[model samples]
Target: MELIAKATALVGGTIAFVRRMNSPQQQAFGTAPEIPEARKQGIMTLKMPAAEGWKDGHLPTCAPGLKVNAFASGLDHPRWIKVLPNGDVLVAESKEQAGPPKTLMDHAAQATMRRVKAIGKSANRVTLWRDTDGDGTAEIREVFVENQNQPFGMELVGNRFYLGNTDGIRVFDFTVGDTALQGSGEKLVDFKPHGHWTRSLLASPDGSKIYAGVGSLSNIGDQGMEVEEGRATIWELDVASSDARIFASGLRNAVGMAWEPVTGKLWTVVNERDGLGDETPPDYLTSVVDGGFYGWPYCYWGQTVDDRVPQDAELVAKAIQPDYALGGHTASLGLCWMPEGTLPGFGDGMVIGQHGSWNRSKLSGYKLIFVPFKDGKPSGPSRDILSGFLSEDEKLAYGRPVGVVIGPDGKSLLMADDVGDIIWRVTGA
Candidate 1:
């Protein structure tokens, strides 16, 4: 017995040593290319000398004769955006960070769990702007609301505007000309904070149901929440009833969601579990089916079982894997479908916002990519529709795009860059 125990210990030590020694590239399970900082910096900072033809005129890469435009510069971490019916854009600026005292405890007997006071920060504000003239510039900049918590994701449905904050979800009736949010908003739901705090909100086409993506509280399931509850799941709530339930389970973090125009299916770009040495699990873009499991804590990306967690053979068999996987750690967000009839170049394509990476030593993603589809599904490789949002010197990024919306003209595209506080316009020449 003693000899057997010694042998087991020796084997475990060897495995641990091997894992630690493996390079980040070797640990990555998929075909994601490792983007070195030097290369990323070079690509991001590459400055193009203004050519006479390309100097100030908009060139349409997606469609002929279409022009894109930008609006409102000098924003501070602008996030989640929506286009109002009046041709104005509504943006949520998330500026607050919940600190340590609010940490949750497993049991009531644990004396360490303490309540913390809610403190307000000046950075939290919501802004609205309108491009009244068709010149692609925001002529009016107005503050819609102020003194709120960290607001991230937003959905504009009918006459109401819904916002996803760190604490929970809130909604207000939106009036076009109102300078300040007049009436008190109603709270739809509340959640215990844990894991990644960025919550993304989406609504059904008819606005009957609302969905919110909540990230896992831990790197894996080490924090001990139910595998089927709270973290890593899409919460579905009836907009009018205010009742909520789990729509889907087992996604580590889904930051972006959109409804496909042709298929009418819900698709999401998910940020997979981290700490598997940078790239074990690849980020994914897939059609999310109700009650489907995407494998968190135990497996990843369709049957690639993880070694960190305890094995569950039955659960592994039941997990529904992603349809398409993007490169790992790309930090994908904000998916929007190209509308019909504006640009031939944008026909049947999906625009995804790669928010860029932070966990790895090297950085990847910082632009908008378009994935063309055949028969209403992703067909081939995605192409860079808009690049150089981050400066040529990758070390300092000028803009980090979070949300994308098709302009009122239908020929142009509008992107919201949170870090740079600027909205960029992409139009075809």
Candidate 2:
């Protein structure tokens, strides 16, 4: 019976693959053939040397046309970053652990003797940096908050600073200009913890509600689909009422969300379900309509259903497919909609951080992409704005970009490089 089931699954998957090959969406699978190699051409390019404990103060000059500057460093796995109104930068440094070594030892002995060393004993905190004296270097460094469990996304709503941690949403009565963040915050929503514990939080434009991105509890539905209440969906919570409800469903792992400036619609970048193959399900960036269903664990990228899981034929028919599908396994993160009329070159653009790929055999997506938005929607193909974070030889990737925002200066772009442990500012010369 097991053999029969496996054979049936294989045949079904083959049929699905063939059907997808013939579809128009197949054109979206490969990288653009005309994408020129990105030249290093900016006034400055800042990098944090990873070898030096990934600390804040290592000054190094990059290739010509790139200037290297340093912000606050000495952080452990900093995930998401936000620039405040006062030009100070707030970074959420995630805690890190060294797991047991992969070696041939007595399994029982290894399990018993391995002591998991925790980094960031003093790092359950968010740190702020400011260039106080106008020397183009950060002079003031301070801790914003302490004892938070793996905080990721952060937003400023009025006088309150909202944070999305591994557990839930938290708020603090803090201002960007305040010297210290010493106030206790109210917990907005409590989420059940599972796989991929980091949650990305954003607020609606009017500050009436909060949007939290909850990733899938498992990779590709291995954890069983019955527990579907909190996994792989964005939950909308009322700020004043603290009432929570599902805003959209069927997303595998939506790590980033932003409010589009032109349309005021909620947009998200999703790290889609993986492990059918390297290129099975493409990661996506889409305008998330309220009450919309994006196919996950059941169907992906439209009508291609997963053969590993039994399909709900009724539900599959109702899922609203994504608007823009990025290439497979790109690990899309840190979405920001460029304010419509800000930059002249970019009429209205969507900037996405492609955190790069580890699951695939081939290296792809170690750069930032700019998707032009016409009127209020995505138009044309996404172009590479920042590149070469990875070595051209593909032997090493020095940085993984996780968060991006229009800098406080309103002309430059601020990006968080998690692996490189530096905040980079890209400005047009």
Candidate 3:
């Protein structure tokens, strides 16, 4: 028994060291790593945190001059958040579903996914939380929108409430202070369903058009590009016509997006394809341009070609390099900007919610990072606003940070903890 235990320990140690032989996150941040000699892999690394909930009354640690509290708790699987005009906050509770595996590699990815509690029955709802007395805690709460299909993003335009679900976009007529979502909603676009899931929606500044990003059906277009007809692309949807057109192409998974305050250009935090080794292809934050392409299965981080796909010289040549790299496999998801001098200390930059790393042996994210924007361009090192979600021993996860937004009052910050099943509020001390 002693000899067997020693053998197991040795194997575990070996795997850990092998995983760390890559670029540090700092090397991947701001600029893409100069991996002139990067190794490619057909297999995805499976180093995930054990899904565990926080103990009662316990909370995530906050940075100095900031205090964190459970603004609301007891949620099913709160993944995304939207703040309304009347100080009401909407939280989307949803889960993902995957098709049966057709290959050994697919089966293995599914198995690792199960270990991370990545799939489950759809919650299919969005709930409203309101702090009526100007307090941080939500005193009134109710189910705002129910019977939805794995909804992930929400937007409000005029009297309409738009929701981005797993398979389509739903729109409803709503008032400023209504708690219940009354309208049945109209589908703006029907998607191919499942795979990467979670379509992110962002209404234009003028509110006449909505920009959305649809994730690919497969990680690296392994299931064939035919299934990815409208997938893996950003869409420009006209509100009046309900007409959707491809805005950009070749982003593997554009999960979170925002418009740069100065440049007014749309930006996205893209989850790049997996199976490339730890340092090969870095997940990036790029300013999206209409008709532009960022290579997914063909090329990565500019013209550094990924040998996984057939040579497409024309497509590779047109692929634009991302503005900044947010570290490899960081799973960066949320984006909200606070103009300079608007908020004390944290003025004039974007706050990104990095949901942590599952593929790296040691976690890379699991925190809210502040990326400073100087004169409309990302500059300087990223700062951690909140962290310590992993346990002291790093064996279990207390929570995973997902959606982040500047509070309705514009003084506080709100973050959705999907794994912890709660919404955390951060206010200045």
Candidate 4:
């Protein structure tokens, strides 16, 4: 079985060379894709460009009047980043560990992982970078926190710093200007292990609680709904009691989230279900309502029922329509709102890092996109601001971004490029 899977991967690997895709029109970015009559979504497309590290002095394409630089490099697989109050940048160097294959599909998935070489070993640590002077780059690097269990998200509220490991949320006390955490941490909440392991976290405005986005274990409940009990939704947890409850449901994968600064509404970028052809369903960025269901396995983008999953009339009825559709299989993950008076002409909008497509015939979303927000709602089309992750030949990618955050000073943007092990800083020139 292993040998056959490996052979299949070789044939599939060659197809990665062909990634140029015929995507929908520009209107597809801000509105939902046209849902076709019910149909069984196709099998996996198995398309992906190999990660090729940047050549000497190579950088991603920046928008006009802006510039890009490697804020910090020479690290392991850094998946997420957070800017601390003290101007230190904390990066989560993590990757999913290869577990034993229990099903034939699992074996095939491992083979595909070996072929793409996209995900690397988790360093199980959060490294810190501090620019001692007023330089635009870091002057010192330290392991701010370590021995974590595939950690991804982080938030510091008052004296307690919270870190979201794949299996749990840990809290540690901290003081200003501390170089490293000294304790093992108090576990706040336990989570189901290692499917979509990135547990994205955000503290409430009042610092009384935090929200965590947990992704589904398998696409469209392929592993059965029984195992998906605590998955596919955001959870709100009380800071003092450590009590958690489901905040929203049917978000297949809420990868990045933030509070809309204007209205204090929570927003997230979701990785929608795949195999839905090239255009049937689109991933989205939307305001997450408390106790809202956005339709994951049984439906997508509001009332479009997924023909593949077991349907429930109640779930279909309760599904809330998303505000904006990004694009089909765009794999949009990272999101950060831009501050006012920082980048003129950008105005008030959110910046999202699109990790690009892996299942589409033609590639989409390999850069930073800006969606203008008016009065706390997405009011314009998402346009590319940074790009060129793909090589000219289209056979290789220099980077795939994950975490995106505005710097603490609000003057620059930081993006975590997991494939290249680099955190890119974007600033006005």
Candidate 5:
């Protein structure tokens, strides 16, 4: 078994190298990315940097005019962040649920994830971090909620605290100042669990509805479309009635979601499908329409048919082109609205945490980026807000960022680094 795993890893690396050599250096970003022809392989590319925690005082490299510090550390696999009304911060710390490997590729992935410390029993808890003295770092850390399914997204609307567990949305009664939840929460809505199991939650500005991002059960519905029902889409749940409906569809893994302050449109960062060329279909950032479809298995990048899934000509024609592309395999997650003046030199835009990639020869998106916006649309080139998550040779990763949220003071940004088990705070230098 060990020998087979080693061979699979070698073959995966060789495939990635060959693909990189054959493909042209095309840009996989911006309003219009150069989408190349697909280069499917029997075994997909699986290049991952071995995860290494930061040592001593090491920190991620902030872009010019910004500085970062550990807001809180020593927590279990922190993946999401939410700020409360009174400047308290909530962090959802969970890891990938373990499952038996069924194929050689699965075995290879499992081995790599184990090296990266990504495979573990989930902590299944949310921790509260308070910077009581207004310092950049949190002095108090407490487990605010515990003993739940793998929770990821969190939101508080009035006294109802909403948690997005892997299989459902749980609601708990709570007050603003309470440090811990008072009772066992009620499941407000059920969601399909496992396969791409992070359910991200975002409440409507009016507090009447909440949005949950449920990823596809399998890559391109290979597990059959029936199992994918209520998956691969953002669901809108009515807060009062607890009823839910699909808000948008065909987003393979829409993780981070935020409202664009200018036009009041919902925006999301999607992790596009892999196994295509190094930069075939780029992951995207787009304004999600109320009932829009951005082609998934049938096609990608607006009407370009994937040819892998059974053709859906009518659905392909209706696919909405994303507003902007982040890059192929960037895994852009952890989105938050950043108004002008929140960070020095950065105007109003969206901050995205690119948790990095493993399916490409050359790594992409191991950093936090900013997409400038004007009138609620992408106006300029994306810039790096924080980087140096990976070593210069790309063999070691210091951390993988996931969830990002603007601080309650509105002048700082807090990011969740799952690999480092730390919450990073960024402010003007």
Candidate 6:
């Protein structure tokens, strides 16, 4: 047994060394990242941290003049958050479903996700928490709705509440002060489900239209473009007529969407494709344009063609460049606008929750970041609002932040830690 253990350790060390040697040296982040030439690999790099739940006073590290605490804990895979006008917080807790592995890369990726406790049976529910006294912690916790198919996004438009489930949009009757969802929802629009299944929903300012972000069915259309029709695009749905159309296209996996108050334009954070060397193309944050394409299988970063993909010169020529880069493989997920006074010493900007990286020899993200905006555009370097999600050795992660939103009071920040199963509140020290 001792000899076998030694052999396993030696093999692991060699594999880690190989990964380090193959990883690109430079990091691609910020508005003008240096996207290097593609270095396609026969086998993709995979580095998933082991899961370790927080215990005995363990918490994330906050930036100077800020503090972090658990607002609610002991939940199950809470991935998204929505704050109601009446001060109630709703959390969407869902689990990932892994499909059968079709290739060597797929097998390795699925195995890593499973080992890190990421994929499992869907929770299929959203829970509501109330803090009536203005304290950071919740005093009331209960199920707001249940029996949904992997719900991710939630929006309340007047008396109607909309949910973005894996397969469709569901509308429920809701009141501002209500504690529980009253009935089963009505299906508003059907969405294709499977690969990259999250459907993030956003409502227009006038509440007359809804936009949904749908990811590609496979990375770079490896499963054929026929299976990718209507995927990798944002869909705009007319509320009154229930008519839906593609608002934008060619975004690989646009997850988080928000309206920039100053510009009155829609913005989104996209997760780019993997397998091209560590820094070949960076995930990005950009203002979404109506009838625009942002490049998927054919190209990236404004017509830098991906040679591996089957060529579409016309489509590549039409691909619009993203506004800013958010670091390669960072998995930057949650985004919300922060007003100037929301956090002391911080000006108006956007707060991003990065769930960390998996396909790099070294990790990136795993914290909440603030990108300062001036005159409606990113003005300076990103700052860390919260960190220390990973352990000192980087072998284990205590938590991973996903959804982010300003509390109803308009001063504090609420973040969802999916691995730790806790909602963390951030406030001025």
lDDT of 5 by residue, 1-429 (tens): 456546655776777778778765765889977888787755778887878989998999999998999999998989999999999999998888868888766788877676567777899999999999997889998889999899999988999999999989999999998889988989989998988989999999999999999999888888788999988899999999999999999999999999998889999999999888678789999999998999987889998888789887899999999999988888898899999999999999999999998888888889999999998799988999999999998879899999999987889999999889999999999
- lDDT score at residue 73, model 6, on the 0-100 scale: 90
Q: What TM-score should be assigned to candidate 1?
A: 0.78
Instruction: Point to the candidate with the largest TM-score.
Output: 5
Output the number of the lDDT-best candidate.
5
lDDT scores for all predictions? 0.65, 0.67, 0.80, 0.82, 0.89, 0.86
Alpha carbon RMSD to native, model 3 = 3.4
Stronger candidate by lDDT (1 vs 4) = 4
Best first by lDDT, ranked: 5, 6, 4, 3, 2, 1
Report the alpha-carbon TM-score of model 5 versus the true structure: 0.97
Prediction 1 global C-alpha lDDT: 0.65
Off by over 4 Å in 3: 1-17, 21-27, 341-343
Model 4 pairs in collision:
21-362
lDDT of 2 at 17: 44
Q: Each prediction's TM-score against the native?
A: 0.78, 0.79, 0.93, 0.94, 0.97, 0.96
lDDT for model 6 comes to 0.86
Candidate 3, residue 269: Cα displacement in angstroms equals: 0.5
lDDT of 6 by residue, 190-239 (tens): 99898988888889999999999999998899989999999999999999
Which residue ranges in model 1 land beyond 4 Å of their true spot?
Answer: 1-69, 95-98, 101-122, 177-179, 226-228, 340-344, 390-393
Candidate 3 has its poorest 10 consecutive residues by lDDT at 1-10
For each candidate, C-alpha RMSD in Å?
10.7, 10.0, 3.4, 2.4, 1.3, 2.6
How many Å off is the CA of 194 in candidate 1? 4.4
